[model samples]
Target: MSLTNKAERSLISHEEYEIVRLTHHPDIYDVAGEDLQATRKRLRDLQEKERTLAREKRRISRGKAEPRGGSFPGTQERPSQRKQVFAAAVKRLSREIDRRARIAARAPQAEIAERALAMRRENFNASHAAADTANEGMQVIASRRRRTTVHPGKVGRVSQRTKAAQARRDAKG
Candidate 1:
């Protein structure tokens, strides 16, 4: 009979019967009718056989020996350090902007106001430039799956209202 047909004919599968048969077999018996040494030897032999099989499997998987040297140098900085530097720079710039805005609000004269606006624009540009550098650095550290958003300062379009107001103010001046 075929192996499959023989297995089907048995009370249980061939594999299951083998396991049951092995479990019931006594390897050695002492004067007290207890098998200690035989059981230990059998268990040890089974464990050694399993280890040998595992080693063979690993050797088969790694067909060729791995190389010992030739590691590439990493260029990217840590995310936390980059974030800390960016945050500190942004905070300092924000405080400067608030201080200038307050001074402009309190001061009188169109010339002073224009100067303040110019200073504000310069400050904004400088901060954005730093932020752009940080963002580029972040691209190297950030996950490949993440998407980047453009900063408002980097956007080139001027609003219609802003353009119209600038025109009116220029005409008045």
Candidate 2:
């Protein structure tokens, strides 16, 4: 008979409130119908429920209405205790809706990341193959290139001995 359980039980099915189980269970995200439209719809519904609970809690606190439990001494139920239950329910719903939003936001990003990784892997494989083939072609082209030869001539100025020999040859001619 936890207050959270009581609050959950009071809510209608349309409100989509589920009882908080005390036992340990996996956090099963309801992502099956999580398209953009569906996500928006669910967020709206959860926000509405949260707002309703908050309103009720406010009403009780403002003394506009009696809280869920009896204020009688025999029952020993306090108004503050009742308010706390609704507050907890509202907080829980808020957290659930926020988690859903985060999950929805991440879904597309995850898909894009997977696609990018696949593209990178494909490109890497292609580049490696191309490089391997190109290396052989490059070696073949290098072998076909003409070999360089050096000329046995003075680079800048002729030597004095070569100049005198040239003069004697010209005088004989």
For model 1, the stretches where C-alpha displacement exceeds 4 angstroms are 1-75, 109-173
After TM-score superposition, the amount by which residue 84's alpha carbon in candidate 2 deviates from its true location, in angstroms, is 0.3
Best by TM-score: 2
Clashes of each: 0, 0
Q: Would you estimate the TM-scores of all the predictions? A: 0.20, 0.35
lDDT of 1: 0.42
In candidate 1, what residue range of length 10 has the lowest lDDT sum?
A: 27-36
In the range 1-173, model 2's lDDT, one tens digit per residue, is 34545454454232343322211124333323333345445545544555665676678779998777544233122334434444454454455657778998999999999998887675655534343464354211123568876566644246767899899999999
Off by over 4 Å in 2: 1-77, 128-173
C-alpha lDDT values of all predictions: 0.42, 0.51
RMSD of 1: 31.4
